[model samples]
Target: MKKVAIVQSNYIPWKGYFDLIASVDEFIIYDDMQYTRRDWRNRNRIKTPQGAQWLTVPVKVKGKFLQSIRDTEIEDSSWAEAHWRSLTLNYRRAPYFEEVAEIVEPLYRNCGDLALSQLNRKFLEAICRYLSIQTSITNSWDYDLLEGKTERLAALCEQAGGTEYVSGPSAKNYLDPVVFKETGIELTWFEYGVYPTYPQLWGDFIHEVTILDLLFNCGKDARDFMKYTK
Candidate 1:
């Protein structure tokens, strides 16, 4: 059966995010949804000596009350440089920092002032390449969106020729499985927190930080600590 996952794009998301991507045959970037403030859409945490630190990408949201993530614009083009600097400062000493940096550093250096959705995709594709994940990534807008959250998700999965729809655990709070059942699509929840600890640089191990943390600390072996990268 063809498995599919539709998720909102996040800025340098945690390892679990990539695990979900790797678990599916087709992954849809659902940036057509409304952008939430102070959410993972424009920020993510990184491990530092002191503790986990946030690197937030400023976006233009002052007047736009209900803007979609695809429509969100970066407030400052320099946020990329600042974030790369933070990563360098915190993870320069990690075992695999240089190798991962060679792949990630150029993305930051060349990222232009693109929309939030476009920016997130650039990083996601780069990391997927590094991890050798071959899942097909597409956009939600590529298909005709239907009304209702459950209806829309089921429709997207069906349109993508997916017999099964894999979602994260958090969506169980409000996601109606009956919709998928009616559409004849099997529904499944992705499990997180199963990853093993790696050679992290910080004092305490935090699994919620960005995937970059795992990449810098474990390099090519980062897939060993993850559940579905293989």
Candidate 2:
């Protein structure tokens, strides 16, 4: 049975995002959906000396409420340098930061993708590779997108030939099980917690931050951390 998940691309998402990705057989990037501002689509948190800080990519969403994530563009070309510097300054002292820096720094150096989806996809792909996650990644636009929320997800699962669908716990409020049952797909929600605190650079342990925190601190053992407790 193949497990599949459809999710909007996120900017250097947390460990849970990769946990879902690693748990599924095929991970679909639902970028065709409308881009919502101030979401994980283009920003995420990182631990800093002061506290947890948000690092957002400046995107041009001036007046386009209906703009799809695939069409959203970066507001300026300079955010890359600033973000890299911020990451460097905050995480430079973390264990294995230098090792991860060699792997991730080049992504900032060659920033050519202007679209938010494109940027998120590139980073997600690289991070997955680093974590040794072999799940196949695809895009929502590649399939026939249906109309409603549950219908769209069910149809995408069918198109992807998924026998099971894995979802984040947040979707429990809106995801209708009947829709997946109609499509002959088993639905399961991923629950977070049971994350053991590792060596953090900051004063206290923060569970919710970008996956970079795990990678920089844990290094090659990052996959061990992404395996959420059952």
- Enumerate clash totals for all models, in the order shown: 0, 0
Candidate 2, number of clashes: 0
lDDT over C-alpha atoms for residue 92 of model 1 = 92
Best TM-score goes to which candidate?
Answer: 1
Q: Which ten residues in a row have the lowest lDDT in candidate 1?
A: 193-202
The Cα RMSD in angstroms, rounded to one decimal, for candidate 1 relative to the true structure is 0.8
Which number leads on lDDT?
A: 1
Segments in model 1 whose C-alpha atoms lie over 4 Å from true places: none
Per-residue CA lDDT of model 2 for 98-141, tens digit only, reads: 99998789888887765889899989999888888889999999
| Model 1 per-residue lDDT tens digits across residues 1-230 | 99999999999999999999999999999999999998999999999878999999999999999999999999987888899999999999999999999989988888787889998999999999999999999999999999999999999999999999999999999899999999999999988866788888879789899999999988989989988986
At residue 155, candidate 1 shows an lDDT of 100
